[model samples]
Structure formats: C-alpha cells, structure tokens
Target: MPMRPPFFALSATLVLLLSIPAQACTLWAAAGPDAGGGTLLSKNRDWAPDHVQILKYERPFGGHVFFGLYAEGNNDPGIKNGINEKGLSIVSASASSIPKKMRAHQPGKRGVIRTILSRYASVDELAADADRVFSGARANFYLVSDRSKVLLAEVGLDGKFSYRVVDKGVQTHTNHYLDPKLAEFNVSIGQSSSTRQARINELLTQSPRPFTTEKFAAISRDRNDGPDNSLWRNGKQHTVASWIVHSPASGPQKLRVVLANPDQPEALHEYTLDEAFWKKN
Candidate 1:
C-alpha cells in the first residue's frame, strides 16, 4: 500500500502554536495533496483574557481589500491574520526563542505584516520585496499562503531573516525559531514552546484524512497540557480568538473565527470570500 499523509494531523499541529505562554499565537498550514487537495491555514491567538479583540476590515487606498483579527481600540497598520481579495493570507507568532538583547530593534518594528497584507498578493510578490520589507524589521515568524502555495518566514530581531516554501506536508510554528541560523540564538524561557509544538504535531499525525474546519477547531480547543499549556490556553495568557482559512485550488475561499475569553463563552462567525460578502463587510 502507498503511504498517505495524515490530512487532519497537519491542521491539528497548527493549533499547537497557540498554546505557548505570553502574548503568543499558534500558526500552521497545509497544502498540495496532503491537504485534501486544498489549503488550510489556521491560528489560535493567545493573549491576556482581558484584551478585547475584533474582526477588522479595510480597503486601503489602492491596495488589496482585506480583513483580519485585531485588538479592539487599536489603530494598527495590519491585522493579526487575514486574507486579501487576491486570495493571499498571512498569520504569525512571536519568535520568542530569540532573546531580547540580540534584537536590533523591536519585533514588527516597521509593521511589516501590515504592509504585506495591504500591498502584496502572493508569496512570490512578498519574496520579490524581501529586501525592502525585512531589511530593518525585528522578530516574528510569518506564514504566507495563496490558493496553491505556503511559505514560512522567520524574521530575527538582529535584522536577519529566512523563508522556506512548504510545497508538501503540514508545517507549524510556535514561539520559537525553526531556521538553523536563527535557532542558534534560541533561548526559549520554558518548556511550553517545545511541548506545544510536539503536542500539535502528534495530533496531526494521529488524525484522519480530508481536513475540515470543525476538526481544526477541535484541535484548537485541545487542553491536553492542562489550562496553562494546552492548545486552548487558560492561564494568565489565554486564547482570545481562533481562525481557520480554507483556500481551495478552485472556488472562493472561506473563513471561520471563534472569539473567546475565560470569563465568557465563545462566539463563532463565518464568512465566504465573495463579492457580496466583501461589499457588505
């Protein structure tokens, strides 16, 4: 018998990135044959339970019309994660493994994520502007995807960066660096990072094929590591929101968002990337 990739397992690993402590997030993406002939981009936004978050939309002057998760009352340049009209989507997590002292400047110092979401339409375009976009930026690991490709990027506080295209299998990231050069500076504070990373991957490998948003949502709610360190965190830093974006090889993309707080029950919202939806939102 030929080997078949555990489809849902790849998406399950994406939720693991959200379990790390501090104001961190979990991000993962799956594409090609392993992704059930479509692409799945997922994230669990971990932060203080008190911080309010909302879905933000924008039609930047001449750039892509897009929307993403944002802290309420914030007037930031970009969103936590979102997909543009061109079908490009980006999600991120802190590169906590890289110490602060080594940072040439604050991570997201130049608001790179916002710029890319507002202007670029694909990983290839982002790559073409790599020099202009990342030259002086600080830390963060970004996962970019379009209808057919997925790319993982690590931006160091020292102004260094690396990116790899994940053309197959499921790829994931937590609050650590996976790039060899960046990993050398790894000084992760606790086991939360490594443990979550492992747990998510384990879930992905054991899961059945043909991924679905519901399955990924189940992974995001995982409390296998207890409240503090499970994929669905409940310690000082907890999950505020979760997102799952399904981009198929053909057809309009779709999104599902779950907003939550330790003090309240979760609220779910869904959207289809169609002309009417964009016009209405």
Candidate 2:
C-alpha cells in the first residue's frame, strides 16, 4: 500500500487552503492617451458558482443616478461596482491582506459603494475627500475613474486610507495590498492573487498603446493561467461577470458587461451614458 502523508503535513495544507479567500476579483484602469483619449476601467468578478449576479439602476434622493452590479438577492449596499451619470466609475477587489482584527472596526460597511456613487462626481472630487468618505469602511482596494483621471484608493477598516491618482497610464490591483502603508499587512493567502496580478501586468505591457474597449474586453476574458488562476477564473469559485467602462473625452461614455453564470449561457450587454439611457435603465 502507498504510504499516507503525515498528520502534521495534512494539517498545514488544510490551514493554507482555508486561508485562501473565496472572493477573488481582478481590477485595472487605464487613462489619458493610452486609453485612446479618456479612461477605461475593467473588472472580472469571481465568486462561488451558486451566487447569481444582477445589474441594478439606482437613483438616490438628491444624489446622482447610477447603475451597479450586485449579487442576486442582496440589494442595498451590495453594489460590487458601478458608473454614475456624471461619468465617474468605480470598481473594487477584495484586499484580503488586511487581517480580520484590522477589519473589525468597520463603521460604514453597508451601502458605502452606493453612497460613493451617488455623491462623488469625478476622480478629483472623490480623491479630495477620500479620507472622510471612506472612514471606517471595510478593507478593500477601489479603482475610481472619470474622463480625465483615475484614482486608486486603499481603504482600511480602522479609518485609515491611502490613494494614488493618475491622469495617464494604467493602475491595477488584485486581492493583495499594493500601497506602501498597507504593504506590511500583506498576507496574500494564495498564489491565485499574485498570479493573476502578474498576468494582468504582462498582458498590459505587451498590449499596444491606445487601448480600445474591445481590447479591454479581450483582456477581461483571458484564460492564460488556467481555471484556478487565470484572469477569467473557472474553478470552484469562478468569474460570474465582467465589466468594462469607457469614458471618452468628447462623447457619451459606454459600458460593456458580460455575465457568465455557470448555470446559464453567457450574456453581453452594452449601455450609453445619456439622459435617455439613464431613464430607461
């Protein structure tokens, strides 16, 4: 009979496997000339196969109107990401590097995404008040963008946050911490996060300058590393949806969405940023 593994080895393996976060997402944004004139924000939302995702149009009282993506059955404060009528867009990925103890003091965990979308009109405005706006929010890395700029904010649960704003080039984030202040807390559980991060960087570097909406969509659908660690995941927990927002310099913005639920056929939806589009959505 084949020899069995030692109990200690098995235990260690189990612990390591358990530490890997189930919610994995890949996020990135491009702005300025490289983006072909405006900004491009993309995300591949991955989660358990059982959770169905949906799109929602919400207009808050005395706030901007927007459309967000959410998991089915969880409405309020459940916005995974969205774009506002003002042309500002935001997307996020889990920052699992921050320990649970650090995330215990979340004060505005609920509806924070919705609140930001409703209130902030541009990358500059959001960056200017990011500290107050994200106070006590749960740990997560958010990529916020508009026609002229892109901002990446790393919000901690203890009311501390850091952000980087860029008018040109690309900014990317995975589940790990990228900010220097938060780097010390980097406890990236599995190779999946790092692998996906590197894959994105590689693809973006090799891609030609002046990226288009089609290029962004192709990147979101990449499966180079395989089912478990590719940009487009297809393992136990897979990419349920992909989002790409293009905010042009002199025209209406466009949103391209692809839903890939395991139980249903993949669907593609597009939207234009305009009064009529907002009203119908």
Candidate 3:
C-alpha cells in the first residue's frame, strides 16, 4: 500500500489554500484626446457577487467606435463603457432598489449597452434610450459625452432612466444611485459614501485646471487616507474606494496613465499611450 501523507503537511496545505485572497473588484479611469478638442472623465468598477466577469467589447459601428458591458450569458457585444471613433464617451454605475411599478413597464432585450452606443452618436441620443434600455435590470447610473457636451443619466431599479444634462462643469460619481425621484431608496446612509466623497473632493480641489490625461490618471491613483498599504480596501473603515477623472481628448497625441498602491507610495506604475498606441489591434 502507498504511504499516507503526514497529517501536519495536509493541514498546512489546507491553510495555504484558505489564505489565498479572493478576486476583488477593480476600478479604472481613462482620459485622452477625443478625436477632437473635447474632454472626458469616466470612473467605473468591475464587481461580482458571482462568477461574472465584466469586460469591454470594442468594435466598428457606423464608422465609429462602439462598446458595452453585459453579464456573461447576455454577451451580445454590449458595452458598459466605451468611447467611439468619433470621440463620444459613455459609462454606467450601479444603482440599487428600483420601484416595482417601474420595473413592470420595461421591454426585455439583450445587449442594451451596445444598442445605445450603436444608435446614439451623442449624449442626447444616448439619453433618449435610457428608459427603454434600463428596463428590467437593477438600477444603474450613466455618464455620456462628446467633444461638446456631457450628461449624467440615472436608471432606477424600476426601469426608469432619467437624464441630467451637464453642459460645462466637473462631475464625480461612486456606487450609489443619485436621483431625487428615487431618493427614498438611497442606501448610502451610514456607509463610506461620505468618506470616499470627501476624498474625491479633496483631490479635485487640489488639482483645479484644464483637465488633462495626466491629471485624470493622478486622480485615479490617489489613496491618501487609506487605512492599509493596500489600495484595494480600507478594512478598518469598512469600504472599497477608488476614483478617476475624465477630460476631452486634445493637445499632445501621447497621454499618461498611472496606478498606485496606497501601501507603497514609492511603487507607482505609469503608462504612456499615444493615439497610435490606442489605435493598435
């Protein structure tokens, strides 16, 4: 008979396996020349309570860039966030607790994100599709823009997607839903919403100028008051936090992107992607 493995070794193996960290969500910020002089600011996180993986799908649509994000089963070239060849940008965020009355009124469909991108060439165009696209799914917030315009779109859990056009100003968003109509369901109370919001405001206040890709990257990597050296989460504070800024793509063809770990300020990663690089296959 084969000899049995030692008890201590087996115990150690189990402990090691248990010690591995889980795959936490990731946040990213992207800004650059918009095929024109307009600026863009976008912030998004990839989250999962299940084995779902959120991805960006890029393709040519109507001679422009089209992209979207959808659940694994609903993959039909949908886009959660993307910028087209014409420089229009779009993105979405989670918003919980939609009204049942609203939920009952939506039309079911696949690839809603892609549908919005393919049909709408501007923020206004995308806003028009909000209610129809948001029906059936949980609440979600959106940021859509082109070289000359910007809009904040909110889709309630009840399938009501509303638009708040922001023509000229800076905007910031996190995980919570922001709509006066759905304010009763806003669950940000007692959460880290205040803390994270404060931090984002602080960073933006520190850097007030014409938005640039470098400035946008710097905002994304800011982890000033994080409890741990790790930028992933503030365990003591009980919250997962991250930030990003967007600007109209203009000026130099090259732009910088940076990622920083709060625990190790000295170890920062930076990337410079130019128009040519962004256009690569």
Candidate 4:
C-alpha cells in the first residue's frame, strides 16, 4: 500500500491555518470641544494578564500625569499604553508574529516600552525615536495622540518602523496594523479582524454630528452592535476593559478625565483640570 500526498497536504494546510493569529481587539476615537474620548475593547482566550491601574504622577518629572491604565510589570514597567502630563496619550496593539530569524538589535538594554514613555514627553518626540525604538522588536501597532495631533506607528520584528499621520479629518484604529506601505501581513485572515472592523465602521457611520463627549461615550458603550454581539450575549459588554477621554481646556489649566466600569454602567470616575496640574510655571 502506498501513502497519498493529498492527506499530508491537507494536514499541512490545517496546521498553517491554526498557527495564524486569532484574536479580536477594538478601539474608537472621537474628538470634542476641548475634549476627546474613546474605548479599548478586547476579547481573547489569552489576553495579557495584567491589572489596570490609574496613577497620578506629581511634579519634577511631569506634574499630575495619569500612568498605567493597562500594564505588565517587568524591567522598566511594561505600560501597554497610557496618558501623560501634557494630556498626551499612547496605546499599543499587537501585530502579526515576527519570524524567529529576526535578530534582536538591542535586547536587555532597556525594554522598548519603558524607554518610550520615560524619554518622550509628547507625540512628536516619540515619533523622532520611532526608528530606534522599534528596531529588533516584534511587530506591533501604536497610537499616540495629543490635543492637536494623532499619529500611528507600525513596527515589525525585522526592525522596520513606519509612521502615518492621521489626517482623515478624524481617525480611528483597531488591533490590526493600518499602514499600506508596510509588508502586507494579511491581517484579514483573522475572522475577528474583519468582523470587528465592519462593526466599527457601522458605529462610525451611525455616530451623531458635532460629536460630543456624551455621544462619543455612547459609541464606546455600544455593545448591541456587531463585534460586540459576542460580549453582549455573554453579559459582559458593559464591563469595559478600559476607557479614556481627552478634552481641551477652557482656560490656562483645563483638562478632564472620565473613568468607569463599563460593565457596571452606573459606576463612574471623573476629574477636572487645574493650572498646577499640567505645569507649575
């Protein structure tokens, strides 16, 4: 009896499919008068095992900055992303897997995650370090924004970093990287990616005109729609993994923060801006 190649070929195809990335993460951004807010929603069997903490940092380094919304503790603090003293916000999303052959240019020096936060105080500053910061690291997508600008950084494990300035009048991002210039990593292979993207698009279309904080919050809390259907069915849609809103100030010192347990709905935390908060001078 002779073996057939068909069976082996089918087995190989199945294995390849199974090895591909399979996870769903969604984010929505909206700007308002002196304020902007959004949501971080995700669902995966093995998401990062981390505790979300909100810390208020005081003077010397940067006065009254909130730190560590979602983070993993290791050398230099693995902040998945967070907001800083200047109301500058940063968020990173996982990209496709990097090939093992890629060499690590600077391993054990200082984790790329910590170096970015400690060194760069603004989005522009971080943009300047994008090349060096992303080298020799696994593929990942980052969103950095301040009151005036929003930028996206896409980095590959091979040490390639691509930058995109969001000038679409308004910009939004999800888990998968969104730079056409980067090597096509085929993010569409993931069923969740397409589904979530469609859902986000739908929400964006339905969003009200003259976007306001309340409307933006509504979009973030929207779970009855696509992408959120699974979470809604499981009765966990409202229990937000994390949420953030950035608004401009009316005077010299003006900023606001709204934090809440989406799952609870009623439970919410709020903060107002102060002159001494952003800077002492």
Candidate 5:
C-alpha cells in the first residue's frame, strides 16, 4: 500500500499545519504498505485567494522544467508547494512563530526551496550538502519528495536543518516544532494537533485494503471527522486550496495532479507537472 509516501507526506504535514487564520498551511506524506505502494503527496493551503497561483519555470542550468504553488508574480523562491522534472515535489508550511535564534545574519531571510531547486535536482543532492546549502539561512519547514524517497526537512531558527525519510509508512507535521529541543521556542497555540494527525494516522494505518485517490480525498474533505479538530475549518481558518500530486513509477514528467481551490471543485487551472513545465512564464 506504500505508493505515495512523499506526496501524502505533504498531505499529512500540510493538513496538520494549516490550522487557523492565514497563519497555517497543512501538509502530509504517506508511503510504505499504506500508500498503495505509490508515492502520493497532498496539501491544504489556507490563505487569501488573491495571493496564490500555480507557477512554472524552466530550470536555469539544466533547462528541464519545474512547477510550484506560489504567490502571484513571484519567482524568488516563490513556491509554496511544487514538483520538478525529476519527480521532485516540494511543499512548505510557514511557522506561526519562529524562534528568534533560527534567523541567520544572511541576505535572504527565507528562500530555502528556491535555493535548492536552483542548484541541485533531487532531495539527495540537497541532503548531501544540507549544512553547506542552508548556511546563512533562516528557519523553514518543508516536505520534499524525489523519485524513490520522501523527506520532512525542518530547518530551525538555530540555523540547522534536519531531513528525515518518510518512506517508512506515514508521517505528519505542523507549524509547531515536534522536536523537544525545538519546542522550547514554539509559542504556537494549537498547531500541534492530536485529533487531526490522529485521524490521518488511523486512516493510513487501518483503512481498508487498497488506498485510492478518492479515499485520500474523502479523508481530506472530511469536515466533521476530527474528534478534536476539523480539516475544512470555517471563518478565518478555512481552506484556501487543496491539491494532490502523484508521481508515476516510470518517469517524473508525467506527474498526475488534481487541485481544488477554496475547497470547491477545481476550475481547471494548470497543475499537472508536465503541463506546468510547458506553461509560458
């Protein structure tokens, strides 16, 4: 059942992070025996609709192609969640509160994904030089996936980033730091969810036989399933966008993507990896 660990890793991570107001974006990734043995990633972006758009670009060096969910007219590491031609998908969730220490005395305060995408091609490449790459960087959170593996990269304000392979079964994270050491600086109210993460965890652990995109959608679209929380919240904390990306077993260009905006049916905007890369500007 382990198909889309990294994809759904974005799913779980995003779901748990996008908690309240414009202060959150949830992400999740699931693989191993529970993900239908395929890599699936999903995200729920909660923000002002006017600021979000799906963007595409040609790699500077390789000139292959890549795409990401980003703010309009933004390319300076503008991707909130996106995938590259190598089937590398990256999604990031902002912290409601970053410890003051994580900030570096560098130029760009936060642009980690774009920096990696601009230089290397895969999560392995980024991981190899994580220390050197993230030097003079601020705190950042992301779920990035390559062809064969998924990773949860947490860069704390202390100027250190940790990457963990979520290819095991399933993994989820929110804006709040889960590391006991990092939690010391976490002043978030409830970004760390017990009910929401638990529901996703249970579904990933004990769902029926084969896991399908529909099943994942159902869980994501579930409004009342959370005993202590809800995925599709209302008021200033409602969903701004929801999307799913699945990498094929053969190649990375033909990534399958389905996206919905404001939690409603999709309006047919460009999202598929191949189509996005082909997009003009």
Candidate 6:
C-alpha cells in the first residue's frame, strides 16, 4: 500500500488527490514560433464527483496574478489551465504510475504549479522554477506557453525532468509519458492517453485552417469518429469538465476561456482570466 503522509504535513499535491478523488485528465496546447499563429490551449478534466469551479488569484507582489478552475478544494489551483499577468499559461496532465522517490520538504501546500504561477512572470521562469521542485515521486506532464511559444516539461521518475519545445500546430499530452528516455519507469502509463493522442492528431489533421479559439474548442470537445479512439470518456473513469483557454497575442493580453461541465455542456461558462484574478476593493 502507498504510504500516507500525516495530515498536518501532507503536501497540497497529496491533499488534492485525496480530497477530490480525481482520476485523470487530458491537456492540449499549441504555441511557439511554429504554432499556427499565436497560442491556443485546451483540456478535458476527467475526474470524480464533477464538482468544479473557476478561481482567480492575486499575488502580494503588487502586479502578479493568475486564474484557473478546479474542484473546490484542490491545492493545485490550475486544474485545467491558468494564465498569469505576464501572459504565461500552464496546464498539467496526470501521467500514470511512475517510479516513486521522495524529496526534501518544500514550503507551501498549494502544489508546485500554483507556487510557480504565483512567483514566475514568464514561461521560461516557470520551467526553471518547476525544475527546482522535482520530488521524483510523481510522473506528470506540464505544458507552459506564452504568446509566441509553448514548452513541454515532463516531470520524470528520475528526480529530474525533460523539456521539449512543442512543434508547430498542436501539442498534446494524455495520461502517459511520451519521452522515450524514461520509458523504463513507465510501469503504469494509462491506456487512454494513446487513444486520446491519436484522436487529437486526426482532428488537427482534418482542420481546414489554422486553429483559432473556436477551432481549439472544437478539438477539445472531440469524441473521436471511430469506435476505437474516443477523446471524451464517460465510463468508469470519465470527463468531469472540458476547458478551452486562449490568450490573445495582443491587446490586454488577458487569458480567455470557455469551460463546460460534462453533465451540463450547454451551460458552458466563458470568462477572462483577468476577471478571476483581480480583486475588488
């Protein structure tokens, strides 16, 4: 059995898993010099109970801020994706079983990603800071993007992580490790990740033109054409909510999003990340 940390000392990351009973999720992003034009990111948050909400935050540093939606009590505020005042956006996908190795204690229980969002001003800084929090006990994937680019940092099972500048068009991650360097430690890579990855490829390939926020949302909602590869799952492990997050390359540079609870698709809520992050007097 997995060893459970004491309640008082439980990391926010650990509490998130225990509190929500969340199973899995799918995160997709597109950016970089080669990305269609600007940035388009999306994700399907597959978890239990389906109780989700959007949250905005302000940093004490005066101008720092960010916004995201997650299960009410989740420590990782950016459950689907979030954008900071600097226009850096982040999204994470849960990779299956990885070799576990505990690391030294770190401050703050808001999970490493939330901590990164609160401190870093750009994608470059986010990646560097995340690199410093490698506990090696978890294998997860994170896609961080700015107006001009996106990067993938796969937190591996080796107390280290790997980075890959996402290619043109779209960058995607399901519930498994895609990098070959750490395949030996991938004992529990989920089967759904491959199915979803293939479906995303087909959808992007069939897109008539470069993706805009609308096109990106369409892909995120894709349920797959064939019987074999379905992107949205409603079985034992299912999609609780779906998110389409986009930040305009220019203008206020605010993060825009369309979030839909699987149980209530037509009731999808659309809001700007700025609205969620800024506080009223």
TM-score of each: 0.85, 0.89, 0.60, 0.65, 0.73, 0.74
Clashes of 4: 8
Alpha carbon lDDT of residue 82, candidate 5? 65
What's the true lDDT of residue 35 in model 1? Answer: 71
lDDT of 6 at 152: 78
Q: At residue 260, give the lDDT of candidate 3.
A: 28
| Cα-based lDDT for every prediction | 0.76, 0.82, 0.45, 0.46, 0.57, 0.59
In model 4, which range of ten residues has the least summed lDDT?
38-47
Q: Which sequence of candidate numbers ranks them by lDDT, best first?
A: 2, 1, 6, 5, 4, 3
Steric clash count of candidate 2: 0
Best by lDDT: 2
List the lowest-lDDT window of 10 residues for candidate 5: 97-106
lDDT of 1: 0.76
Off by over 4 Å in 5: 1-22, 49-52, 61-64, 73-77, 97-108, 191-195, 225-229, 251-281
Q: Could you give me the TM-score of model 1 versus the true structure?
A: 0.85
Please report how far candidate 4 places residue 167 from its true position, in Å: 5.3
Quote the lDDT for 217 in model 1.
82
Displacement of residue 255 (Cα, Å) in model 3 is 7.4
Tens digit of per-residue lDDT, candidate 5, span 1-281: 55423322344444544343434556776664455565667666655434445545645665446666665642222566666666677777765454222232435555766666656677677678777765545675677766556777766654656667756455666565666656643544353343455555666666674555556666666566432256644445555566666654444333334444443565435344555455556
Candidate 4 lDDT over residue span 169-227, tens digit each: 35555555566665444323344444555665776676655555455556555555443
Clashing pairs in 1: 9-204, 17-26, 18-26
